[model samples]
Target: MLTLPNILTLSRIVTVPLLAALLWWPGWATGYLLGFVVYSLMGVTDYFDGYLARAQGAVSRLGIFLDPIADKIMVAAVILILCAAGNDRFPPLIAEVHVIAAMIILLREITVSGLREFLAGLQVSMPVSQLAKWKTTLQIVALGTLILAGGFREQVWMHDLGLATLWASAILTLVTGWDYLRVGLKHMD
Candidate 1:
């Protein structure tokens, strides 16, 4: 439907490769800064696309389908890139105590996605809950902070704060994920 909201969503999907490329070189601090800027812009567009779609009554099947896919792709790419970078202090974002949290978040995404697909096939909609919104917020903050930490490696606090947020995000992920799974199970045979 080439609507403005749809256009915004597609733009996010299109530019993710550029984001990935920017994060590919671990030593490129300036590149991580640029990547952070790009990632923040993507997050902004994500908010507006959904808002405009709702406000203008322009919601479409295409937008609905692409929105979560774009989000998952963005989140997955950032996580993988950050985890692989392995700085002097953190080594990997998923190292030590952060590993379980990261794994939980990643696994929940996969589980919820599959659950959504299964429910969709049954004509059952799994609406986003308020807690799920918090989960998304925590994820954005966690990843964005981690990216900024990459840009400013000397700031141990930045990475620490990012790790804190990552754990919080993981906690919320478990809660919201179980909620979704519970709803999904009810729709199953």
Candidate 2:
């Protein structure tokens, strides 16, 4: 139950509040820089946790359950933080039309989670699609780059690039999310 991979996953869950604290003050560029480093480390650990689990044949039910939960928690936290206002240099990522994008991602996550739970209860497995993986990758890059943009306030380009990625991810989110829903609906009744 307490394998190294699980420990790493648990560490990410444990440290999210600290991550939120770092982002609490938007004016704190130093804090944002540190948050970026911490966020990057969390991403690295996310990779290794699964890699080590598979390589060592240490995968467990606990690991399978916690991994996605940790990921969602981290992503949600960062999104909510970035959506709030504070720094003049770094505006809210979810401002104006971006709110629709952000809401799309959030809504998809909730919908898919509920669908997964329903399928699980029916003893049906809904394997992740390849495009879903791409959506996850785009989302991580979008959020990470946005956080990094906060650290580099002078680099408006970073913010713009981050916004670009955010919209791209949102587009992917809609596609993958609808795919999941289509499959899920088939098993509904």
- Give the range of the ten consecutive residues with the poorest summed lDDT in model 2: 85-94
lDDT agreement with native, every candidate:
0.89, 0.89
Off by over 4 Å in 1: 87-90
User: Total clashes, candidate 2?
Assistant: 0
Worst 10 residues of 1 by lDDT: 86-95
Query: What is the Cα-based lDDT of residue 14 in candidate 1?
Result: 93
TM-score of every candidate relative to the true structure: 0.95, 0.96
lDDT of 1 at 187: 77
For every candidate, C-alpha RMSD to the true structure in Å: 1.6, 1.3
Evaluated with TM-score, which candidate comes out highest?
A: 2
The segments of candidate 2 whose C-alpha lies over 4 angstroms from its true place after superposition are 87-90
